[model samples]
Target: MCALRTQFRYLNPYELHKIIINQYVLKQPEDIKLLQRNKSNDRTDYHVLVDHHRFLWEDNEPKTWEEQFAKRYFEKLFKEYCIADLSRYKENKVALRWRIEKEVVSGKGQFICGNKICNESENLRSWEVNFAYHEQGERKNALVKIRLCPSCSKKLNYHHKKREIKRLKKQSKYKKKKSDSKESGSEDETIVCDSSEPESSESRRIEADIPETSNETPWEEHKPEVIKSREEEMEDYLQDLLI
Candidate 1:
């Protein structure tokens, strides 16, 4: 019976069928239904959906994958994912709208929290994380937005409007301060010039009070000699009268 069992092992169609079937089953599903079911069970898994889009914020309804990613979902996730430090997740790389789709198909890339502390991971389908810049001609400001997982979103309790308003206010304040400092500096220079004018005039007066011997002429010294000669002639006439 042992020899017969060993001889039949290679011919066991059942074992061969089982192996073939398992491989076929694994290869059949384009989508991982198990993961989908798991994600659906927990709201936190929804963050993976954000990876489907890439935009920071949508001005209007998103029309293209690039537009959707750049403008709509990504910004929302960033607020949720933000954590303290934000530097440890050095392996995370920024994705372009085009690259995200390729990564999703390959089942490789996932969005990570830009914040180092959070280091949260999510599927590309759930959370859209985008790094964009707001630009109008030469003016530009960096915009970072992450579509947060449900758990992260709940944890953050973010206020988008408030943050935006605060950012704008800071910019305005900085501009005003810069303008004021420039004006004050210019005014100070003018005041210094005005103050120095009087000192310069006083210095000129002090210089003038010092007698200048260089201005004396040869004729001015001879006038003293002529006066002495006239005085001598008057004394001589007085002596003759006495004689």
Candidate 2:
């Protein structure tokens, strides 16, 4: 492929971008030629030039195509050299899966709500926000604990669902636009937005029924009031005595 484009010294941004994108496919091994000769080191090197910035493969032999692709391929190569990030936004693929566990508070003495605005200690529960992220190509699991009162927990869950619905809708919209452009024979490579997987039926239902601008939730009207704990009353008595 590099030999075929001999007319140009190095591939233009679009040509190089396409090749990098195709490197994700594991089906075929990439055939790269070591052409450039380094006189000082007396070694032949493989070089790729983007916008006059040369990227040289220092090794004498090019590694397998899979090994060539880095975990931070988008940031390192695409964004740095090709200027793809200027016109096109790459979808962030972190924390797609989460494992949230909520447990009722037992034998607690006035636990402050983790919500910055809400300080209610009544009906407190411990919520663990567990998710995974890739740092330097290693997958790391993170667990964050937050103690929240019933009302705050409900509010958190409600807002989370709302945001999730919006995300699904935005992905669907982008996919529609991409497909439409493809059918019209004017495919826009810049619009590379798509969901990693299909959205569930429940997500579709929420997107259809829930209005993004609405501040109100369906269960808010019937939300149970948080009863004051005996520990709270005892603490209040102690404060009164201190006063």
Candidate 3:
């Protein structure tokens, strides 16, 4: 007998829930907005939907293109699926807003934790971390926010603190090493000076042992000797002959 094509038999809670929502949720058709007549052009302004829509939680401020898209997508998803109360899933109001913003900005379809290890799609919270980067040869600090599961969020905090401690320890070690090298260099210089002092003192003692002499001519070095002339020698010989 030929083997039957493989099929998925197991379903997780989320998958089951999604199936039930798809089958039971009441999806309503999109309602068309009334066309506004402009006297100048005698045409409808289609830009009203985009230009007039305001985002939630902001003082009725106009929404950006990303925000608008996100809002529409969220509403459509809710209409098609029986989504649980978003407040229960959101750790805070900020987290829900962040999730929505990320959806449209990043064009992501599912709301999942940013962590690769734990990509939980439910019960997410938003956190802001200080991210340092270099721009145009200058260091800059940016506040980067992301949604994460509770476990991943805890891990992120712990990792950040540990990294900070490690950086501080490395800085302190480098400073201590630099100070030690400087002290060693000074000691070497002092040792060299101390060694040279003995040689200088020895040279001074040798100079002191040597006797100093005043300026004198070379003939003065020998004692004076008596000299006899030829006539004096002849007279001495005559006296000897008379005797």
Candidate 4:
């Protein structure tokens, strides 16, 4: 189906924002691989995968019949499932099948939060924020893209934290490698930044020629003059006693 504009014109800005944020689905394993009824879902609430490629973009706007229909379909589900009655949403969608797409980008995109409560701008660093829509009996998976400022992204999307951690670790490791390379290069160049005055080569030679006190024997450290004075005192005292 083609993405459309007419069907979505009736939706106000607030509803559109909510539809954008709350309606899209994060990717799940079952979305790619078929699973048994019990294994199909890790979520207690009904969530589905969204196809990013299906939503066609014209002038950076969702302007196709299929895309618009998907938006409307997801909005309907959002109201009924997430906001309204879950039972009714599930009941209405058992046989209904359709394809819709939400806007998504992997990295380095502007983010405007579709949450009515939070309109946050995010630095696009990784592929963590996702969008999803429900498909009928068949399970499907496609990642919807979103952008939010660091704080809002973390608050709205749990995957944001994981991706952010990875990003930080990668950046730190890169910096460490760069630093190690720089240090090694400096050592190769002998770039020592000693604050003390550097000694002249002649002064260094003199210091090397001088005997190192550290190697001196303990007895050699005693003064010969002191030993001679002690010996003379002892001889004089013995001479006086004999007299």
lDDT of 1 by residue, 44-110 (tens): 3244444343233435676665555445445533232322232322433233232233334432223
Candidate 1, residue 122: Cα displacement in angstroms equals: 29
TM-score of candidate 4 versus the correct structure, residues matched by position: 0.22
Candidate 3 per-residue lDDT over residues 92-164, each given as its tens digit = 2111122334344443323666553444778766655555544335566544455566666565565343122
Q: Quote each prediction's TM-score.
A: 0.19, 0.19, 0.22, 0.22
Global CA lDDT computed for model 3: 0.48
lDDT by residue for model 2 over 1-243, one digit each (tens)?
Answer: 677567345779897767756764443434332433557754222332121121222243425543344222322432111100111112322122211122123212125555544456786765554444554355666544455577655654542321221113355888898888788786434667677998899999988998668888899999999889999999999999999
Off by over 4 Å in 4: 1-117, 122-132, 154-162, 165-243
> Model 3: which residue pairs collide?
none
The C-alpha stretches of model 3 lying farther than 4 A from their native spots are: 1-110, 159-243
Residue 109 in candidate 2, Cα distance off native in Å: 12
Count backbone clashes in candidate 2: 0
Those runs of model 2 whose alpha carbons end farther than 4 Å from true positions after fitting are 1-110, 133-139, 159-243
- What is the Cα-based lDDT of residue 83 in candidate 2? 6
Indicate whether candidate 2 or candidate 4 has the larger TM-score. Answer: 4
Candidate 2 similarity to native, TM-score: 0.19
Ranking by lDDT: 3, 1, 2, 4
